[model samples]
Target: MYRTWRFATGCNDACAIDDYRDICPVFFFGGIHSKKGFFMGIVRKPSVTPPSSRSPVDATPSRTRPGSATFGDGPAVKIFRPDTDQAQVEVPRQSAAADSMITVSSMPSAQILPMHPMAGSLARYSLRAPANLPAANALGLRVFKSRNYVDIAPGEIVLVRETGTAGEYRAALVSELVALGPVLFYHPLSKTWTLERPHPLPEPGKVIDIDIDQLVRKVRKEHAQKHRVHTGNDDSFEYSAAQEGALVARGLKQFPPEQAAIIRSELQAVESIFADAGHAIGQNYKDADAVYESFFGVDHHAVAQRFADSVARGQALSSEYQGTWGDEKFVGVDADSNSAAWMYKRDFHGRFFINRKYMQRGVLSISLGHEMLHTNRIDRFQTIGPNAADYFYLDSRLGRLLNWDTLADYDVPERSVSDAIMRGGLTVEYLNAFTNDHDNFLFGVSDYLGIGDDLPLQTAVDLFNANPSLRAHLAVNNADSLVYAAKSMQTLHQSKTEYAWLDSLIDD
Candidate 1:
C-alpha cells in the first residue's frame, strides 16, 4: 500500500525502495521473513497521517496472530513518510497558531508614527507627493500637487509663488517630513521659512513696505516732473520778464509808492532800450557783476552806485543836452564793470586804466563825441588815444549838442548804434563812418589810431553795417573767443601785475 501510495502521489523515498528490498521483512498472509533466512511473523506499515486529512491510518497487524514480539516503538520512528524521496520535515502548525493569537492582541493599541526630520524640512516648500504614490502618502504635498508638481526632497531649495502675492518667493526644504498642517511660511527678516512657525499677512488698509524697484520708478518720475527742461519758444522772453518782475517785486517791497512808481518807470525805459537795441542784457550784466567782484575784490553794486551818483552830477551840471540819458548810465556801470565790459575794450590800449572809476562816462564820451564831427568832416579820423585838437576846434561844450544828423547828411541806425554802445566797440570814428557822414580829421586819424590796425577800419565798418541776424551769429562766436582771451589775460595779470602791484601797495 505504501509503494502504491508513493507511485500515485509521485513520491520517491528510500523506504519505498526498501519495501521492495529482498532483505526487508515481508508479510504474506500474516507472517514475515528476511531473505537471509531469519523468520519473523510480525509485519506492519508505519502509522501515518495524510497531510490533506486529519485522520490517522492504522498499520496492518502482524501476520502471526498470537506471539510475535510486538514492536510497539517500531524499528526506527520517522517523522516523514519513508515511501517519498523528500527530506525529513516538521510541521509548524503549533508555532503558527501562537503567533496569530499574539498578533490579534497587539492591534487596537498602535502608537502614532513619528515623521522623518527630512520630511518636516520639505514641508517649508509647498511641494506635493509623487503621482504614483498612494493618496495617504500624498497628503502634505497638496500645494505642489495642485500645481501639477511633486515635492522637493530635503536639502533642496525651490522658488515658489508666494501665497496671496503675485511675485515668487524662495524656500528651502530642510526636512523630509512635517507633522503640522502644510503651508508656506515666509520670514521676511531672515529670508527663511519655519516648519513650526508661520506668519500672517497684513490686515486690510494697513500699509506694507514698498519694493525697491517701485520706489526707484516713483522717484524717477518725480525727478522728471521737477527737472524737465524748458523747451518753449518764449524761454528767452520769459527770462527777461522774470528779471523785470524781480526788479519790480524788489521795488514794491522796499520802496514807498511814489519811489516804486519812479523806479518801475525807469526800469521800463531801460527795458525798452534793451529791446529796441537787440542788446543781450540782464543775465550777462549780472555775470559781469560777479567778474567785477572777482577782478577788483570789491562789491560791484557799491562801485556802480558811486559811478551813478557821479554821472547824475555830470548830467545835471551840463545844460546843453536836452534828451533823457535815462537809466542808461546806471545800467552801463553795472554791465561794464563785469565781463562784457572787458570783452568790449579788450583790444583797446590802456583798457585797465580807461575803465577804472567813471572815466568812460566822463572824459571818453565827451572826447569821442567831439572827434566824431572832425572824422565826419575829413572822413579819415578814428576814435582812440587823445583827440584834444579836434575837441578844441569843435569846442567840447557845443560838440555835445550837435547830433550827427546836423553835422552830416545821414541818420544813424539807432539799433545798430545801441548794439555797438552796449558791446563797447562803438567808437566815434566807426559810428560816424557807419552813418555815412563826412569828416576831414576822421580820414586823417583813421590810419594813425592803433584801433584801425588791431581791427582794420574797413572791417569795422562792414561789421557795423551787418544785419541783425548776421550780427547775432557774430556776437555768439565773439563772446566765446572773448571769454577765452579774458581768462588767459586774467591768469597772466594775476601772476605778473596783481602780485607785483600788491607788494608795492601794501605795507610790509
Candidate 2:
C-alpha cells in the first residue's frame, strides 16, 4: 500500500506534508509498504542541513532505509524533531536590494548633511558610489588640479578640496580632458570657481597684448598738442621780441651813427690782420664765428659774411694808420658799460678791450697801439715792475710837447729812453729817503690814488705783494715802502690831472 501524511497549522489548512517508503524511515514525496508487516508507509522526522555544511545539493531519492521493523498497528508513528534546527530554516532574511532601500531612507541626503552651506554647494555634483563617497567627503570642498581625477569623465562634476591646513572648498565641472587633466569651469567675473566650493584659485585668462610702438606714437601726438597750446599766445612772442629789441636799442644809443659806422669798419680790418698773421698762427674763420655767435647771437654763415665785409673795410683803415699814432692788430670793444678797458695775455697772444662808450676809431686805434707797445716791452725786458718808472718819467719830461713825435724814435734805441728817464730826476737819495718813511704815505696815497676803494686798501696791498712779478716793480729800489709810497703818490696825482683834463675838454 502507499500512503501520505498531512501537517496542518492552527488555521486548519494543510500547510506542509510528507510521504515515506515502506521498510524504511526516510521521507519522500511518495510512500511504499514493505513485507515485514502490513506495510502502510514509512514515518521520518523533518530536519534541515547544518548551517555550516549547507550547500547546493540534488533532491533525488536515495535507497538507504532506517532499521525500524514491526510496523503493524502502532497507532501511526509520529516523528520527533528539534524545533531549533527547524527554526533556522523557517526564517527568511532580507535581500541586498531591500537593505539598500532601507539605508537610503534612514541616511540624510548630502544637501541636508550637517555642513556649511558653501560646502553643500561645492559637493552638489560630487556624489558617488559608496566606495568612493568616503574619499570624496574626506576631500571636502576645495580647489584642486582637474588632472588629479584621471578617471573622471568629461562633463562630469567633481569635488576638489584643497589639500592644505588652511581648509578651502570648491566644486567644479570637468569641461575638457586635456593632456594635463580635466579642465574645470572657472568664472572670471566672480574670480572664483563655478564648482560649489569656497577657495582661492590662480588668476585666470591670458594677459592682453599691447603694441608699444603704437602707444608711443599716440603719446607723442598728445605731447605735441600740449606744446602748441602752451606757446600759442601772440603776447608771449611780442613780449620776448620787444625785450630783445630794447636791449639792442640801448646798445645802439651809446654810439653816434658815424662812430658806429667807424667801429664796423674797424672790425672789418681785423680779417686782413689775421690773414697777414697766416692761417697757422692767426685767428681763423672759426674764431670769427665764435665772436659773432657769442656777441650777436648770429648763425655761423651770417657771421662769416658780416666778418668778411668788416675785414674789407678794416684793411683800408689799417693801411691808413699803419705808420701813424693809431695801429694795432686786434681790439675788443666792451659793449657793456660797467666794465673797464683791459688787456690780458694768453699762451698764443695778447688781447685788448676798449670800453665801447669811451672809444671811437681814433681813440681805439691809439689805445690799442699803446697796449701793443706794452706787450712788446713785456716781451723784450722780460722784467716787470716800478724800475721802469724812471724811463716813463724821463720820456714824459723830454717828450713834453713832442711826445707823439718821438715814440718811434725812442723805440730805435730802447736804452735811450731808459737813460733819459733816469737823468730827468730819479736819484738814489730820493729813493732811499722815501723807502725809510713811506708806509703811512703809501696807504694814504693809495686811497687818494683810487687803485681800489679805500675800504679794500689792505686787500689791494696784499694782492699786489702776493704776485712776485707785480711786487718786483714796486720794490725794485730795495726800499719797498718808498717805492709803494712813490707809486701811490704818482698814481693819485696822475689820476687827478687826467680827470681835470677830461672835465675841461668835455666842458669845452
Query: Per-residue alpha-carbon lDDT of model 2 for 41-112, expressed as tens digits?
Result: 122222121112112222223323235622221222111111111000011235877976644322222221
**Per-model lDDT:** 0.25, 0.27
lDDT of 1 at 101: 67
For candidate 2, report its TM-score: 0.17
RMSD of 1: 63.6
Backbone clashes, each candidate: 33, 20
Choose the strongest candidate by TM-score. 2
Per-model TM-score on C-alpha atoms: 0.15, 0.17
